[model samples]
Target: MRLRDYLRINVWLLPIILILLPITLIIFGSSYLSTPNTYFNTQLNDGWSVSHGDNHYENVNLKNFNLGNTSKGDVVTITSTIPDMTAPAAAIMFRSILSTVTVWIDDEQVYEYGKDFADKNLMLPKHYNFISIPESAIGKTITITFDVTENNAFSGISPVYYGNLFELERSYLQSKRLDLFIGIFLCLFGFMLLTLSSYLYMYHGQDLSLIFSSVISFNLGAYILCYNDLFNFIGDNDFYFCIMEYVTLYSIPFSIIVFLVSTHPELNTNLAKVFLSINILFPALTLILQLTNLVHINYFVTALHIMALLEAAILLPRLVMNIYRRYQSRKNSPDYTGMTSDSILIIGLVVFIFCCVIDIAKYNFFNEFGGGGVAYTGITFMNLGALGFVMSLFVFYFYHGIEHINAAYVKEHLEGLAYTDPLTGLMNRAKCMQYMATVKGNYALISIDMDNLKPVNDTLGHLEGDRMIRCFSDILKQAFDGASLIGRTGGDEFLVAIENPESGICEKMIEKLETLMAVFNDADKKIRLSASCGFAYSNEPKLTDANSVFIMADTRMYRIKEQHHEDKLSKFLDDIISGKISQKGGEEGT
Candidate 1:
């Protein structure tokens, strides 16, 4: 409920948001109001030209333009020259015909396509030639040859040449260095924000679902802008933006649903079910559209991203408000409360929504208003949501964890009242069976019976016998403190189990019982009570279950009590017979 509680979780998440959110704004949100004037500057690197007169056998379609074959005579001439030759960067070009496509610079075979070139380099694709010429190849005249070999595919057409994209050059030299450096700077800074955010989620024990989703968003951006040339790192703009496009595609919807589910725990189950089903369906549909190229799923995703952000904006506040109200009522009442957790969660959700909306507005609306200056809000706000998410999850998990511990305590305490004997405070017969059902391992079960307990009840009254029962149960508790379980199975009966069967413990315990009997009567007016105990230890796992152990102990105890009773009866009969014989003899002699 208080601000200190919010900070506990917020402390970790803030730095990440401060770093990443701003980057999100600068990279994507920067052009929101207007495109920057700097975007007008385009540095051309791999620019080449071919006149209509330059080709001998040319096809209107550029596909496979470099290679063609004719049975008798096939020829195509290419006039090659490198721009910025003094700059010392090799300009690469390639041509292919039939089985062979040779690459040349400075009039020599720098790379051969579809040949032993595979052995020389592992990076080379087996089916295509992606050649590179060193900067040393510049300032020299170059001749290229694409000799037709076997001509199995196209034996009768002459070779032709076509244009390629501008990529073969990179400049360390700064004709326009400041502008380039600035763009790179923004990107690096943005990347740091993104990385910081990810670390917060992974390290702070936050929910990984949205963390992973946001990570995918960041990855999408890097994939589009900063990958290597093997995938045409600077391919046609259409293909090059695919990664960014897909990033928006999946992450937009994913982020929305993750926010909804994590932040709203009390939604109706039916509504949640429907929403979750649709969530799965939407992603799958989008993936299908992408893989098949059935339609440009990017368009839907981008449009949906804006919509989803708005929905999150609306839903997040409502949920937070509800959590706050509930927390206020429950804070100190102890019914069930998690004010700090709810507050952190609400704050994170609200700030994240606001940040996202601002980002969207900055990109689509503000960027269009003018060049990049008026439009793009630079990244710096990421810390808000980053910190919020961390705190929210911390609170969320903590709330649940504490609730679980309390529940366990309540259940155990309540169960003791229900199943335990009131007088002895041991488990009753019902509890004995329950314990037998519940417990396992090697144990010693002791079944005790007071010798001639009914006669004491008859002579001294039931109250005195009851006191004896209570005393004996207390003795059982003392004998097996932490070593075993002592429970009142029924009237004058106790059941106990000890782990790993220390049978010597039984002897010491029985001796203590005898000592209690000797001292117990004088203080209580000459009422003597002795108990016989039978116990057995089973080492076998299968035989060590409670029921089997109890039966064995009970059987052993009965045998000891029966033998003592027989000895006492025999002595009493002998005394009576001797007394009667002496009396008859004395009477006859008189």
Candidate 2:
């Protein structure tokens, strides 16, 4: 009904709208945009023949072509007729994995790769083979030979493309634009998370979950870029990028485990620790073996898949159980709120694991049944799943951060209320005693007592007395602006403690107090402001601690107060005797 209430109720919708509006517009606008079509290139998916050691297949479908079984050093030869091409610069393009390739256009050699790697006993990395076709080669039979370099590596062949070289490359990159955007976005997001988490850890002592999340995000992003061969834009070193791909991939599970454990310590079970240890060891061992030429990292794909499945088997159930228990325990409580960050995290984890299962299943399924190809031209479900998981982690991190900040704010506010005097905002008596009881080092304690407080209360009311006390407290604050401590110790009683006071500093503060009081009294005629103050340094003889110094200061302050009283009485009597002032109702002049 009210504007404030409406705003309060709908404030959360603002971010949702801001996020969804752009997405909706993009979805809507995309329908009107022209669809991408091949202008200068064509996919050659049919009319291919394959020959492998005593076996020959005719009219094989190149799009889903595969050799049922293959061994290291096995050779598979494929031949296809190049269609008519009008483009001046022509080429045949396809991707190869873990294989050395040689291309011949009607017996004239046109392209070769991985011969050096094979000679050196190194793994051949996956690469896009773009063989330039001579203008005279049109209508000629194009023969390609794949020398499989690893067991189980020759799963299937990528669909061949023939046309203008640059256009084919452009189309290829254009198809990968979404994946590129996501990969780069994720890397940048991870860097931003690292920066923010580092600051929070240094200043606020936050946990390492944010750091782990950042690592996971960066690794996943790198893995995406490398696995898709998009990182070739940055560098043409396919071998190093292949290593990076596996390294980043193997590193992810460890960071994920660490992040989960950091966020939910309850998840740090023995099984999780074992998984963490294996995740740590697997990558290092694999990398060492690869570098030593004992075994290539590509051969460990099945092992990594098994490890992931095992981890998910142990973690997913426990995570779901943990979320269930937490929700059940808190559901009926008055403070209950639906869907905690942990719940969101579990959901994200489930979705991520699901996507991984799909990818893994697809890989195995196609290898067994659908001609052994696992490449998707556009963004994969794994990428979308990873993005969702990372977003969930961001939500979890920020939710807890905001919760911590709110808790700290409430604690500080409560502490302020407990220690501070409501009227003058000075330290209360309890806080003063607490400070004095534990105070260390050399210091001077000044005891201050306001004069004529009771008389002001009797004549002008307690409100005026309170005003006088506040005025005196302000004077004390101004006099000892940066003093160690100032407090209202009792009614009309105040104390100022200065640590390591300079020579004559105590006297100077007392003089300043008197001057401020004089100025305050001159400005206001309602009540004369006066206070007797005496300070004793801790270095004074026989002053063992703050309490002793305080006692000495109080004693000296009483002596000053007695002198003021005596002087006031004498002045009043002098005035009365000289007929300058008169007593009212036989009362003594104050």
Candidate 3:
């Protein structure tokens, strides 16, 4: 119906179309990309033998193979025959966690990892091992040795795969494509939020909630990408990514706590302060210990987990109670709109906490009961929770922003009403006084008074008098268009102030006012309109302030009014003496 309505509808529709287009294409294209290349890849799971100290196991299925009663420094050896394959080049791929791996094909060493780190008592980074298989050794017996570097580091060997390297990599990445997309999206989104928050903080002086949100999103995204070995596909720097994984993991809780405390000040209790301090100090201490080789960063995972759970347990209930109280207080109020944001935040926090608890419980369950190892698939319930939480925060931020804008607009409107004159649409006396008190520098103050206003009101009615006043005010506004202030100080009095006026500017403005009055009087012959105006410059001798200049101008204006009365009286006498008016009419006007 309207152009603005059309534009608004398009604005809403365009983003949806843009978002769905790529998704539709990806959905259709994924079938082709996700088709498995079974001929080039094979999982080598069966017919493996394992040997430990004074023990041997045969026909071991490598999938979740239990390394019963293992300790640090205990060595386990696995042997299997390489499957026959006609590929030009092939490799064996498996993931190693906190262990040193050595592979040999018929007594010739092929690939080794973590040996140096293990020897130096340094923490070993987890990564996938892709050992190239010689074409001649396709049917050769392969001996794989795993030296355990930590207690219960892994209770089972991961399923190994024999495949073309590129094909194996492709398959692994295909399985994790969703994780990749979400992880990258979160990282980029976090970066954009971080940049936006920084600008608002530095320039606009906004609060820090968005900054904390950005940190939470970016760190969680990075942890997901690294923990699942998905980062290996992007950058194969195992040690750096491993460090990033731990650092980003530790940073998430810190950012989350700060965000909660900043957004809801009631949550910033003494206990919260202590947790905040610990979050800051503990991560730095662990990093120092890891760098100095005294202890590995991984050693504190359980402690970190416990601390996170404890922090949530202590703070979540307090937050819930606070939000509940606020909701109850405003339940019946007409302006109650904040509950939506509060509910979103609460839902997000609950989902995030639930996911965290699930992940922690699953980790402990698998490690203690199911096996000694946990599989990280890059995309977990925790990722979903993080996304949910961040989205909720974004919604809250936008809603809060809208509320702030609305408040500012209402405040500005009220201020305009307070300072404006209703009748003539000019600044009222209060605003004029305010400007006069603050005005500075070389300026001119023009005081204006309408002539014969009382006589006009008495002869014609008050309405005609009001119209005359309004007409004169319009003329003053036009004449003083470049002035700093044009105000109706009283019913028949007005003022114009100009700052740093050029030479002869006041004279030019006065002449312009006279010319406009002449034009108005010629057009509207109901009343002969006239006004007396006098201006005083701030730079003149003995003029110290705007008020002083205004007083001087008012004094001059009264003197001009007296002179106009004298001239009108003298003209009337001349008309009578020249017999231009009859003797009886002249006596009646007198």
Candidate 4:
């Protein structure tokens, strides 16, 4: 295949390669290099004990070797022997923890986390920490102990890994690269959508759907970033992190539902409103609670996720039903096309829903697998679905807009043709009548009849007669610069209307017409142009409308024509008697 054809076929792969492929490779490559070694996997589940507040560590061997939920001010100490690995640094990776921890190596405090302002805000996100093993401690027994003062989830500690610090950090990045990419991808993509939407709204037409989709994208990006462990390297403000986490998580579904409603406004039913309220109200309540330190997010994460899943389940089917009904109605219509954005949206939602289900399972049921190798979860699926759906909807919006613009252009052109005079390029009689019927206020009318038009056609051919009419139309337009309407009313007849005409405007127009006729006659000696003109103003009580003004003007025009004919007859008699000119044929008398 040609390069163009190949690219066209694989266009969707571009984003995946650009945004996600590098992270995937890093995950697998690091996992391969960091497979468990004998020294790194040394067992530390035994010889552990616990004590209450303000107590030094004690060695109590427990049957169940797990750090169960530790209350505030509770301390946990684990005594373990470190093998002589002779490594530069040792590290401990916590699969999941909700407590502040302090680690000591051989009576020396190596690292302490989660202490701020006398341990008032002491929650720490799950992460890996490094402990430097000094050269003095190698080949000697080292005491490792940590205190877990608080926790909200898994109230106890699960298995921890003692490994090379470099290898552990590499593994940590590999597992986090997916979420990191997703967070960055969402932020960047949302910004792009906002820019595109602004351009479209300004230039093409306003599409609220683009705006809503951008909102969803930004909300979900923030939601993922709040959970990203990389933030640990940035700050230790647990309260801010917790508030952002809950707030952003709550906003995601609410924004998505809002986007759906914007796309299909017809679906703004009571049921949708209820779903919206749930999505918005719960998160908002949760955010308030977190801000006040009234509740921990772990208390409501499962319920909120269930709400998100339910919202998706309900909203998708309603969307499908709406599309089905619309399709049925349009199937018999002329311009009907097949499935629309709704179908593509359903597919995207399904992808998103599937990923969500998997993530719920990963976080709730099979939670042990986290902080290990990279696991495919909702983040991947959500990104896939959001990109597909938003892109499809954008294309649809532009497509519909283009179709409407083209249709309007065609209609406007047809209307122009209907109301225009073909030969003279002036308004046709139809337009003139319509204008007169709709116009308000005082107006003036002029009725003009071309003189000797039939004689010109007979003597100089029909082409010259047409040229005379065009020249007459141009002079009429130029003379009546501000006329409300001008048209070729009939063969050899023209009419003009001017609104609120001053007393002198009509006399000035007639004088101007005579001047233009004299000028044209002087130049075009072969085809002289002249016409009988009559004018009337409608400001008086007797002439109440434009039609009445036109009738009076037309009557005056015929009377003027008769007077011109009588004058001509007398002039002919004088010319015959004086022998200055000769009348030729019966045509001259006629």
Top candidate, metric lDDT: 2
Per-residue lDDT for 402-456 in model 1, tens only? 6545546657767888887888788777777876788765667677777756887
lDDT of 2 by residue, 1-590 (tens): 43234434665964795498448545543434334545567888888898987889999887666676577978989998989765768888888888899999888888899999999999988888888877788899999999988888856777788888878877776666656766887899999999988997999787788889999899989888997889875688989999999999888888898898988889998888888899999999999999999999988888888989988898878878987897798666433434456776887788888988888888777776675355432237788788878877877765555445544665677889999999888999998999999998888999999998899999999998899888888888899998988999889899999998899998998999889888988999999998898889999999898889999999999999999999999998898897666545345645
- The TM-score of candidate 3 is 0.83
| lDDT of the structure predicted as candidate 4 | 0.67
Per-residue accuracy of model 3 over 252-286 as CA lDDT, tens digit each: 88999999999899888898899999998888888
- The models' CA-based lDDT, in order, is 0.51, 0.82, 0.81, 0.67
Least well predicted 10-residue stretch by lDDT in candidate 1: 38-47
Residue 317, candidate 3: how far off, in angstroms?
A: 3.4
Model 1 scores a TM of: 0.48
- The reply for model 2, stretches above 4 Å from the true place, is 1-11, 14-39, 203-206, 316-347, 376-379, 437-444, 455-464, 474-484, 498-509, 519-527, 536-556, 569-590
User: Looking at model 1, how many pairs of residues clash?
Assistant: 33
| Total clashing pairs for each candidate | 33, 0, 0, 6
Error of 4 at 142 (Å): 7.2
Minimal lDDT window, size 10, model 4 = 369-378
